[model samples]
Target: MSEAARHELPDLAAMAAFGARLAERLKVGDVIALEGGLGAGKTTLARGIIAALGYTSEVPSPTFTIIETYDAPPVRLPIVHADFYRLNDPAEVEEIGLDDYREGAAMIAEWPDHAGGFSHEAACLSILLETAKTGRIAIARGGGDWLGRMP
Candidate 1:
């Protein structure tokens, strides 16, 4: 386990900027696990990442659909955005062909604990969001190329 570093984002724009920075460092097969309370901006951050990746369409929360796939232009690989808040068990993930999404995809999972454990030697980047007096606090943990660019 690695210690998380805290970042202060005074506003939504700052948070989105942080997300953009994170997107710049991501590659296929990367996994971002988000840990945050309701309305802590998990989806907001993800939206920023998708937009930064050149997705022009609206990026909606995957709460109902469970997962949304976006194809990376030119690269041809996919980005899997998942929300497992409604999951009853980790095993339920298998039913959705979650494993199939892992190959050549950057996965952003909100409520990743529902997946039990990451099967591959996936680069795990955990993001924890909290409410601070001035703004929101974004905490990141993990050792990877993208980790360094977080804060």
Candidate 2:
């Protein structure tokens, strides 16, 4: 495991702030793997990143559709938001054309383990979220490209 950093999010606002902070350093080809139990704010943080990138439209959860794509121009870069919770096997990822969707786009993947994990990817950032008595907490572990850039 790579060295990790912890951030305390007292509420949805704080999580949004963290996501905005993360957006400042984002680039194409980055993969964010979000891991946590139900209602852990994975989608919330992903929304923050998308909003911070200048997307004004509603950001819906990809739970059923599996993947959602946001084009560039309105945003600085293309982004792919995917929810892999429904997947029963890693092989299902290929059927969804994840690699094709990921080309030249940053990906925020929920339940990434179902998609075979992103830790091996050079620009992957894995975040584990947990509910706390007050709110929630996020622990981020970054791969080689994200080590020094983790917030």
- Model 1 stretches astray by more than 4 angstroms: 1-3, 74-77, 117-122, 143-151
lDDT of 1 by residue, 1-151 (tens): 3567788988989988988877887878778788788888888888888887778778989999999989868223478999998899999998999989878898889988877744234387888888888768988886454445544
Off by over 4 Å in 2: none
- CA shift at 39, candidate 1, in angstroms? 1.1
Residues 81-118, model 2: lDDT tens digits? 99999999999999988899999999999999888999
**Would you list the C-alpha lDDT of every candidate in the order shown?**
0.80, 0.91
What lDDT would candidate 2 get against the real structure? 0.91
Q: Which pairs clash inside model 2?
A: none
What C-alpha root-mean-square deviation, in Å, does candidate 2 show against the real structure? 0.9
**Which run of 10 residues does model 2 get worst, by summed lDDT?**
142-151
- The true-structure Cα RMSD of candidate 1 reads 2.4
- Highest TM-score among the candidates is held by which one? 2
